[model samples]
Target: MANIPYREVLGSLMWLQVATRPDLSFAVNMLSRFANNPGRAHWEAMKHTLAYVKSTTHYGITYCHDSNIKPLGYVDADYAGDTDRRRSTEGHIFFVAGGPVSWASKRQDTVALSTVESEYMAFSRAVQQGIWITSFMDEIGLPQDTPVLIYADNNGAIANTQNYKNHRRTKHIDIRYHFVKERTANGDIVFEYIPSSDNLADILTKPLARDAVIRCCVGIGLRDVEAGGVL
Candidate 1:
């Protein structure tokens, strides 16, 4: 592990994710946690990511003039995804002009006792990104409609945002996560329920099968220049 260039490879992957590879966000974010002490398994995972990158060099986000300019967001979370700490992984992506403008995949700072709680935390993160996206759009003279549409797969979390009632199942969740509820109430953002199978943000919260990955890639407007079509 000491001899391997783990940090160097991670650095390169990080740049790729930040610049042109929203599809690699989850993999790179997960592997980066082991930069200080990567083992054989981590190295193997890094190699797999590198191989995927190599295979999809022609893949890039495609934006069309007819695409929707209004920013939309998708958010999801994997409950107890972290093997070492049992923390949830929250992921989000914002789209403009049919292409991803920003996205993120990160483990939650606190352990969530329920899937709903984790989803709520993910909602909070997505709302923060939505606020920023709307602000930028306004500055560029593309002001968005009120109550920015944000999609979530969890009905429980969506209900939480709509209802102010405190229940035992969610009362224990941190006050910070309730920021999403405030945003929803104020019409700054809205959480609409989407089916898990159709949620694009699912790709960012966990490792996916090949078909699911390809579907998500296409959903995010990733296209292959060589193939001249969505990937």
Candidate 2:
């Protein structure tokens, strides 16, 4: 681990993640967490990621022009998934023209008290991104006529956010995360539930099985250029 160029290789993957591979964001972000003091296991995980990229080199996002320009979003969180810090991992993806345009995966800065809290935090983060993207779209003369739709897998979190009165249970959460509540009140972003199985952000929230990863990858618009057409 000490001898391997972990930082350099991770940087390369990060560039790919930002440019075209939204599916790689989670693995890249997770690997980047250990860039400073990578263990042997971490190095091995990096090698696995590289192997994945090599196998899916033909896969990439395909954007079609027939669809509207407004962004569709999904967000999810893995409850207390970080082994070292007990922090949840937040993940989100935004799509426009029927293909993923922006995505992120990262360890949360604060530890959540419950699964609902983690989902709420992740929802708030996704709202912030959605708001920013809305503004950007307006600037480009493609203003959204309706509220941005954000899908989440947690029904409780959706209900909690739509509740104007902060229950005693949720009073402990930081006031900053209430941004989602305010935005929702103004109809800037609408939250709806998608089954966990259909939530594309699930792939970004945790290390999934290979089949699951490929499924999410395709869901996000990655397709192979090979003749087989099966990834």
| lDDT on C-alpha atoms for all candidate structures | 0.91, 0.88
Q: How high a TM-score does candidate 2 get?
A: 0.95
Task: Name the candidate that leads on TM-score.
Answer: 1
Write one digit per residue (lDDT tens) for candidate 1, span 107-177.
99989999999999888888988999999989989898978899999998888898887778877675755
lDDT winner: 1
Name the lDDT value of residue 115 in candidate 2: 93
Candidate 1 similarity to native, TM-score: 0.97
Off by over 4 Å in 2: 226-231
Cα RMSD for candidates in order:
1.1, 1.6
Off by over 4 Å in 1: none
